[model samples]
Target: MTVSAPIASRADAGGGTPQALLRLDAVGRRFGDTVAVDGVSLEVPAGEFLTLLGPSGCGKTTTLRMIAGFEHPTSGRVLIGGRDVTALPPQKRDVGMVFQNYALFPHLDVWENVAFGLKSRGERGAGVEAAVTRALGLVELEPYARRKVQALSGGQQQRVALARALAPEPPVLLLDEPLSNLDAALRERTRDELRALLKRLGMTAVFVTHDQEEAFALSDRIAVMDRGRLQQVGSPEALYGAPVNAFVASFLGRANFLPATVDSVDGDRAACTVAAGVTWRARLAADSPRGAGARVRLMARPEALTLAAADEPNALRARVLDRRFAGAATFYRMETEAGPELLVQGGPHTASPGDVAGICLVESAQPVAYAAEP
Candidate 1:
């Protein structure tokens, strides 16, 4: 069962409008001679959760800062609800921000911290109290309203920070690795709560993370960035199933790339020969190169392969070099005479180290092909 429901907030009330809630047009930022973000462009629809995913120094954080108006772009425009806000200061942007450290005031109690946004905007008395109470309830923190920020646990502090950000009911929410400070187990649990809350409230959010699992779990769509440039933007399933390039295929999940030379193209399928002159069929990307002899790569996930009998057609004999038991599954590092080292995963009864096995790619594998990087 899914956790999403029909969005019924202000964002969707104007049902006929075609404009995106947030738009970035060729945005770029430079610091001295270093390019921090370059030519990044995307559109986020209202009530959708988008995640900026990449490694450190890849400009995910810089992009988020630009959206929040904390950093000005050098070359492009930022549009929120169809208005250009590139020159606006952080305070002027109606964006709620949650940081990695929570950033809650050490001396302020939960209630005061959450009410700060409303109070700054001239709200007071019963109205302010009511808004604070609602925000705390959304994060399940109403019982801890009088607790000091320093006295709460890490997860509790994160909840307080999130409550403070949402108290003002901003149209867009930006989170910069908000769960990074929590332990592994707590981070997992908190992420679940966060996703559910955003969906239930019909909130539009952009989350930044280097963790692939977190991005996959929370985003309706993911925008992958590298070296200050936008790489690919698509739904999580699309990004994982049909990655645009070698970098994306390897980064989003574990993929074994086999070097091959294209022999022929039949519609969207390509026949390629690997190391032993064994021909294999692979699916072609929409922009895949079709020229014969063009160097390309065949990508297959570890779970897509299985063990076959010695005489099975389209199978290769390999020896398991290492085995790791991971409870529900067993991972094997297998070396084949047909060439590259392949990582294969199977049930707990899979091959052990020193065992010889016949490895075969399942017909459902649908391996993707990409031009080999120079």
Candidate 2:
């Protein structure tokens, strides 16, 4: 059974020194000739929600399976609370896992399903009843406790699965794309509820998802993976505002990459020339080298480029090509006189197609720069 109560008393529930609750040291997994996960090392501190985010076939699911003891790593160690449990089976690992499919028993009611683990693990009589009730209440599903799994809505069924997994209150929770099966709106709502619930319980969790928005919404930190390797790991803001590479920048959010040649460097900022007369300042990645005549890429979000007066500094003459109207924002596709296309985000555009305008890069907004791809 999952360990519901704290295994040991922590100094603080959620605000301690951020002790490592889970650690993966150089973990690797191989399936025949294919390398599923390659030398991934990560440490998830107590009460911090970390996400393994990537596209399909990126080894995110493989990594999560390894941690859950569903798949053994070909190399390295998996530790929980300073205990090496690399060779332990899933049941012995003290982890509660919620899979993509709810994995609920169709014949069992919500209460019985949630109570299965507890009862099987020797919890009896009043203890099993109380634990099931508490778990159902946590998911706000007590009213549906008698309902069959197939009779519930997708969201309700998700709640039941969550309740079942949480009934054991394992010190660490492993969720593998738990919301992926729901509709978009339900997924959003469920993710919000999941984040709120985990935070309230101060539970340490490792979530895996390919949905960038979901990862940003629910994780304290995200580890972006690609092709069986970790690309970057950081807080949502840090990853979005200051991506270490092109993949991280493009993967995290919408970014418009502009090719440039570095003209000069001063400290963490550099001057780059995008065109014959268009020179702009951009922030370099923290560990990137500063040098003259270096080829680099400047990344700006759609919102970072706004309509400006024709005479404004760093403004480029462009003609609107198309406009996409989103609910809260409008995206404009424009072609610059300097021969580059740009996307600018605004609300209710004043300029129509074929209208010439000045698109200015926000001077104070330090766009992220990285070494250009070969």
Estimate the TM-score of every prediction.
0.94, 0.93
Best by lDDT: 1
**Candidate 1 residue-wise lDDT, 176-263, digit = tens:** 9999999999999999999999988878899999999999999999999999989899999999988988789899988998888899
lDDT of each: 0.88, 0.86
TM-score of candidate 2 on Cα atoms, chains taken together = 0.93
Assess candidate 1 and give its lDDT. Answer: 0.88
User: Model 1 off-target regions past 4 Å?
Assistant: 1-8, 16-18
- In terms of TM-score, the best-performing candidate is 1
TM-score of 1: 0.94
Model 1 clash tally, residue pairs: 0
CA lDDT of 204 in candidate 2? 88
Clashing pairs in 1: none
lDDT of 2: 0.86
In model 2, the runs with Cα more than 4 Å from the true position are 1-15, 286-289, 309-313
lDDT of 1 at 29: 96
